[model samples]
Target: MYVTEYPKGDVDKEIDKLNKKLSRSFSKDATQVIRKLQKANCDALGIGRHLIAFYPNTWKEKDKNEYLRNVKFKTNVDVEIVQVGIAE
Candidate 1:
Protein backbone atom coordinates (compact mmCIF):
# COMPACT_ATOMS: atom_id res chain seq x y z
CA MET A 1 0.00 0.00 0.00
CA TYR A 2 1.13 3.58 -0.71
CA VAL A 3 1.39 5.87 2.30
CA THR A 4 3.66 8.76 1.44
CA GLU A 5 2.69 12.41 1.53
CA TYR A 6 4.46 13.18 -1.73
CA PRO A 7 2.81 14.30 -4.93
CA LYS A 8 1.60 11.68 -7.39
CA GLY A 9 4.33 12.19 -9.95
CA ASP A 10 7.04 12.08 -7.32
CA VAL A 11 6.03 9.17 -5.07
CA ASP A 12 7.37 5.98 -6.61
CA LYS A 13 10.16 7.67 -8.54
CA GLU A 14 11.34 9.27 -5.34
CA ILE A 15 11.99 5.87 -3.83
CA ASP A 16 12.99 3.99 -6.95
CA LYS A 17 15.27 6.30 -8.86
CA LEU A 18 16.46 3.42 -11.00
CA ASN A 19 12.91 2.71 -12.18
CA LYS A 20 12.73 -0.52 -10.25
CA LYS A 21 9.42 -2.10 -9.34
CA LEU A 22 8.38 -0.89 -5.90
CA SER A 23 5.01 -0.93 -4.12
CA ARG A 24 3.99 2.39 -2.65
CA SER A 25 1.32 5.10 -2.46
CA PHE A 26 1.12 8.83 -1.63
CA SER A 27 -0.55 10.47 1.36
CA LYS A 28 -0.31 13.81 3.18
CA ASP A 29 2.47 13.20 5.71
CA ALA A 30 4.47 10.61 7.61
CA THR A 31 1.97 10.12 10.43
CA GLN A 32 -1.16 9.65 8.35
CA VAL A 33 0.68 7.35 5.98
CA ILE A 34 1.24 4.71 8.63
CA ARG A 35 -2.29 5.00 9.92
CA LYS A 36 -3.73 4.49 6.47
CA LEU A 37 -1.68 1.36 5.90
CA GLN A 38 -2.83 -0.06 9.21
CA LYS A 39 -6.42 0.76 8.44
CA ALA A 40 -6.20 -0.81 5.04
CA ASN A 41 -5.02 -4.06 6.48
CA CYS A 42 -7.99 -4.28 8.87
CA ASP A 43 -10.61 -2.90 6.55
CA ALA A 44 -13.29 -4.94 4.80
CA LEU A 45 -11.28 -4.87 1.63
CA GLY A 46 -8.35 -7.20 2.00
CA ILE A 47 -4.82 -6.04 1.35
CA GLY A 48 -1.54 -7.85 0.96
CA ARG A 49 0.42 -9.39 3.81
CA HIS A 50 3.47 -7.31 2.95
CA LEU A 51 3.96 -3.53 2.94
CA ILE A 52 6.76 -1.53 1.36
CA ALA A 53 7.83 1.85 2.75
CA PHE A 54 10.36 4.27 1.34
CA TYR A 55 12.81 6.18 3.46
CA PRO A 56 15.59 8.66 2.87
CA ASN A 57 19.18 7.56 3.01
CA THR A 58 20.01 10.07 5.74
CA TRP A 59 17.49 8.59 8.17
CA LYS A 60 18.91 7.40 11.48
CA GLU A 61 19.07 3.65 11.87
CA LYS A 62 17.32 3.73 15.20
CA ASP A 63 14.44 5.77 13.83
CA LYS A 64 14.16 3.39 10.92
CA ASN A 65 13.94 0.37 13.18
CA GLU A 66 11.46 2.08 15.43
CA TYR A 67 9.16 2.87 12.55
CA LEU A 68 9.34 -0.69 11.36
CA ARG A 69 8.51 -2.02 14.80
CA ASN A 70 5.64 0.40 15.20
CA VAL A 71 4.12 -0.54 11.87
CA LYS A 72 4.28 -4.22 12.65
CA PHE A 73 2.67 -3.67 16.01
CA LYS A 74 -0.15 -1.67 14.51
CA THR A 75 -0.80 -3.58 11.30
CA ASN A 76 0.81 -6.93 12.03
CA VAL A 77 2.14 -7.10 8.51
CA ASP A 78 5.59 -7.30 6.99
CA VAL A 79 7.15 -3.90 6.38
CA GLU A 80 9.95 -3.25 3.95
CA ILE A 81 11.78 0.03 3.54
CA VAL A 82 13.06 1.30 0.24
CA GLN A 83 15.80 3.89 0.42
CA VAL A 84 15.46 6.95 -1.80
CA GLY A 85 18.73 8.56 -0.63
CA ILE A 86 16.91 11.88 -0.21
CA ALA A 87 14.81 13.08 2.70
CA GLU A 88 11.10 13.46 2.10
Candidate 2:
Protein backbone atom coordinates (compact mmCIF):
# COMPACT_ATOMS: atom_id res chain seq x y z
CA MET A 1 0.00 0.00 0.00
CA TYR A 2 1.28 3.46 -0.86
CA VAL A 3 0.09 6.73 0.58
CA THR A 4 0.99 10.29 -0.31
CA GLU A 5 0.16 11.37 3.22
CA TYR A 6 0.22 9.23 6.33
CA PRO A 7 -3.11 8.76 8.05
CA LYS A 8 -3.88 11.64 10.40
CA GLY A 9 -5.42 9.61 13.19
CA ASP A 10 -4.83 6.19 14.71
CA VAL A 11 -2.39 4.92 12.12
CA ASP A 12 -2.82 1.22 12.89
CA LYS A 13 -6.60 1.37 13.06
CA GLU A 14 -6.80 3.44 9.92
CA ILE A 15 -4.66 0.98 8.00
CA ASP A 16 -6.80 -1.91 9.20
CA LYS A 17 -9.97 -0.15 8.13
CA LEU A 18 -8.46 0.65 4.74
CA ASN A 19 -7.52 -3.00 4.31
CA LYS A 20 -11.08 -4.16 5.02
CA LYS A 21 -12.55 -1.68 2.57
CA LEU A 22 -10.04 -2.68 -0.09
CA SER A 23 -10.85 -6.36 0.46
CA ARG A 24 -14.56 -5.75 0.02
CA SER A 25 -13.92 -3.75 -3.14
CA PHE A 26 -11.71 -6.53 -4.54
CA SER A 27 -14.29 -9.21 -3.74
CA LYS A 28 -17.01 -7.23 -5.48
CA ASP A 29 -14.82 -6.78 -8.54
CA ALA A 30 -14.05 -10.50 -8.58
CA THR A 31 -17.76 -11.35 -8.45
CA GLN A 32 -18.44 -9.06 -11.38
CA VAL A 33 -15.67 -10.73 -13.37
CA ILE A 34 -17.03 -14.15 -12.48
CA ARG A 35 -20.52 -13.19 -13.65
CA LYS A 36 -19.15 -11.87 -16.93
CA LEU A 37 -17.24 -15.09 -17.48
CA GLN A 38 -20.23 -17.25 -16.60
CA LYS A 39 -22.44 -15.27 -18.97
CA ALA A 40 -19.97 -15.99 -21.77
CA ASN A 41 -19.74 -19.69 -20.76
CA CYS A 42 -16.05 -19.25 -20.12
CA ASP A 43 -14.68 -21.31 -17.26
CA ALA A 44 -11.45 -19.39 -16.89
CA LEU A 45 -11.20 -20.38 -13.25
CA GLY A 46 -11.50 -24.11 -13.83
CA ILE A 47 -14.48 -24.40 -11.48
CA GLY A 48 -15.67 -27.29 -13.62
CA ARG A 49 -12.50 -29.20 -12.95
CA HIS A 50 -13.05 -29.06 -9.21
CA LEU A 51 -16.71 -30.00 -9.54
CA ILE A 52 -15.98 -32.90 -11.84
CA ALA A 53 -13.22 -34.21 -9.59
CA PHE A 54 -15.14 -34.04 -6.31
CA TYR A 55 -18.81 -33.99 -7.24
CA PRO A 56 -19.12 -36.15 -10.29
CA ASN A 57 -22.80 -36.89 -9.72
CA THR A 58 -23.63 -33.23 -9.34
CA TRP A 59 -21.66 -32.40 -12.45
CA LYS A 60 -23.50 -35.09 -14.40
CA GLU A 61 -26.86 -33.65 -13.43
CA LYS A 62 -26.20 -30.32 -15.22
CA ASP A 63 -25.51 -29.59 -18.86
CA LYS A 64 -21.81 -30.31 -19.26
CA ASN A 65 -20.75 -26.99 -20.81
CA GLU A 66 -23.58 -24.68 -19.76
CA TYR A 67 -23.60 -25.42 -16.04
CA LEU A 68 -21.47 -22.49 -14.89
CA ARG A 69 -24.14 -19.94 -15.72
CA ASN A 70 -26.48 -21.53 -13.19
CA VAL A 71 -23.89 -22.10 -10.51
CA LYS A 72 -23.66 -19.85 -7.44
CA PHE A 73 -20.29 -18.32 -6.58
CA LYS A 74 -19.27 -17.05 -3.16
CA THR A 75 -16.18 -14.85 -3.27
CA ASN A 76 -14.10 -13.77 -0.29
CA VAL A 77 -11.08 -11.51 -0.49
CA ASP A 78 -8.49 -10.69 2.15
CA VAL A 79 -6.07 -7.80 1.77
CA GLU A 80 -2.90 -7.23 3.75
CA ILE A 81 -0.77 -4.12 3.69
CA VAL A 82 2.66 -5.64 3.98
CA GLN A 83 4.69 -2.53 3.17
CA VAL A 84 3.33 0.99 3.30
CA GLY A 85 5.29 3.28 1.02
CA ILE A 86 5.21 6.93 2.07
CA ALA A 87 6.65 9.38 -0.45
CA GLU A 88 9.01 12.01 0.84
Candidate 3:
Protein backbone atom coordinates (compact mmCIF):
# COMPACT_ATOMS: atom_id res chain seq x y z
CA MET A 1 0.00 0.00 0.00
CA TYR A 2 1.13 3.53 -0.74
CA VAL A 3 0.94 5.69 2.37
CA THR A 4 1.39 9.39 1.81
CA GLU A 5 2.07 10.93 5.17
CA TYR A 6 2.61 14.58 5.92
CA PRO A 7 4.24 13.85 9.24
CA LYS A 8 4.53 16.58 11.78
CA GLY A 9 8.04 15.52 12.75
CA ASP A 10 11.03 16.54 10.66
CA VAL A 11 13.30 13.71 11.92
CA ASP A 12 14.06 11.23 9.15
CA LYS A 13 14.97 8.44 11.57
CA GLU A 14 11.69 8.79 13.42
CA ILE A 15 9.71 8.79 10.20
CA ASP A 16 11.42 5.64 8.98
CA LYS A 17 10.63 3.89 12.28
CA LEU A 18 7.00 4.93 12.03
CA ASN A 19 6.83 3.63 8.46
CA LYS A 20 8.16 0.23 9.54
CA LYS A 21 5.63 -0.01 12.33
CA LEU A 22 2.78 0.86 9.98
CA SER A 23 3.92 -1.77 7.50
CA ARG A 24 4.05 -4.47 10.16
CA SER A 25 0.64 -3.53 11.51
CA PHE A 26 -0.94 -3.70 8.08
CA SER A 27 0.69 -7.01 7.30
CA LYS A 28 -0.42 -8.57 10.57
CA ASP A 29 -4.02 -7.43 10.08
CA ALA A 30 -4.15 -8.80 6.55
CA THR A 31 -2.66 -12.13 7.60
CA GLN A 32 -5.23 -12.55 10.33
CA VAL A 33 -8.10 -12.03 7.90
CA ILE A 34 -6.62 -14.57 5.47
CA ARG A 35 -6.23 -17.13 8.24
CA LYS A 36 -9.84 -16.73 9.29
CA LEU A 37 -11.03 -17.18 5.72
CA GLN A 38 -8.84 -20.24 5.28
CA LYS A 39 -10.13 -21.82 8.46
CA ALA A 40 -13.71 -21.30 7.27
CA ASN A 41 -12.85 -22.80 3.88
CA CYS A 42 -13.92 -19.60 2.26
CA ASP A 43 -12.19 -18.81 -1.02
CA ALA A 44 -13.46 -15.26 -1.15
CA LEU A 45 -10.40 -14.17 -3.17
CA GLY A 46 -11.31 -16.42 -6.15
CA ILE A 47 -8.02 -18.27 -5.82
CA GLY A 48 -9.59 -21.44 -7.18
CA ARG A 49 -10.63 -19.71 -10.36
CA HIS A 50 -7.10 -18.47 -10.94
CA LEU A 51 -5.69 -21.92 -10.23
CA ILE A 52 -8.06 -23.52 -12.72
CA ALA A 53 -7.06 -20.99 -15.35
CA PHE A 54 -3.31 -21.09 -14.83
CA TYR A 55 -2.52 -24.41 -13.12
CA PRO A 56 -5.09 -26.81 -14.49
CA ASN A 57 -3.08 -29.93 -13.70
CA THR A 58 -2.41 -28.89 -10.13
CA TRP A 59 -6.00 -27.83 -9.68
CA LYS A 60 -7.39 -31.14 -10.89
CA GLU A 61 -5.38 -33.14 -8.33
CA LYS A 62 -6.96 -31.41 -5.33
CA ASP A 63 -10.41 -32.16 -3.95
CA LYS A 64 -12.62 -29.29 -5.08
CA ASN A 65 -14.50 -29.05 -1.79
CA GLU A 66 -11.41 -29.11 0.40
CA TYR A 67 -8.97 -27.11 -1.69
CA LEU A 68 -9.30 -23.96 0.37
CA ARG A 69 -8.69 -25.79 3.64
CA ASN A 70 -5.56 -27.42 2.24
CA VAL A 71 -4.05 -24.25 0.83
CA LYS A 72 -1.41 -22.27 2.69
CA PHE A 73 -1.44 -18.52 2.36
CA LYS A 74 1.37 -16.14 3.15
CA THR A 75 0.46 -12.47 3.20
CA ASN A 76 2.95 -9.67 2.77
CA VAL A 77 2.16 -5.96 2.89
CA ASP A 78 4.62 -3.36 1.68
CA VAL A 79 4.01 0.24 2.74
CA GLU A 80 5.92 3.17 1.29
CA ILE A 81 5.60 6.54 3.00
CA VAL A 82 6.01 9.29 0.45
CA GLN A 83 7.28 12.35 2.21
CA VAL A 84 5.87 15.44 0.58
CA GLY A 85 7.70 18.23 2.36
CA ILE A 86 11.35 19.01 3.01
CA ALA A 87 12.99 16.52 5.38
CA GLU A 88 16.78 16.37 5.13
* Model 3 lDDT tens row, 47-79: 999999999999999899989887777887876
Best by lDDT: 2
**TM-score of each predicted structure versus truth:** 0.18, 0.76, 0.75
lDDT tens string, model 2, 58-83?
Answer: 88888987888988999988887766
Q: Which lDDT tens digits does candidate 1 get at residues 18-84?
A: 2233322221243466666655444222222122224334343434333443444322223344433
Candidate 3's displacement at residue 81, Å, is 1.5
The worst-scoring run of ten residues by lDDT in candidate 3 lies at 1-10
Q: lDDT of model 1 at residue 16? A: 49
Candidate 3 differs from the real structure by a C-alpha RMSD in angstroms, to one decimal, of: 4.2
- Clash pairs for candidate 3: none
Q: Spell out the clash pairs found in candidate 1.
A: 2-24, 2-25, 4-27, 5-27
Query: Largest TM-score belongs to which candidate?
Result: 2
Ranking by TM-score: 2, 3, 1
In model 2, where is the ten-residue run with the lowest total lDDT?
A: 2-11
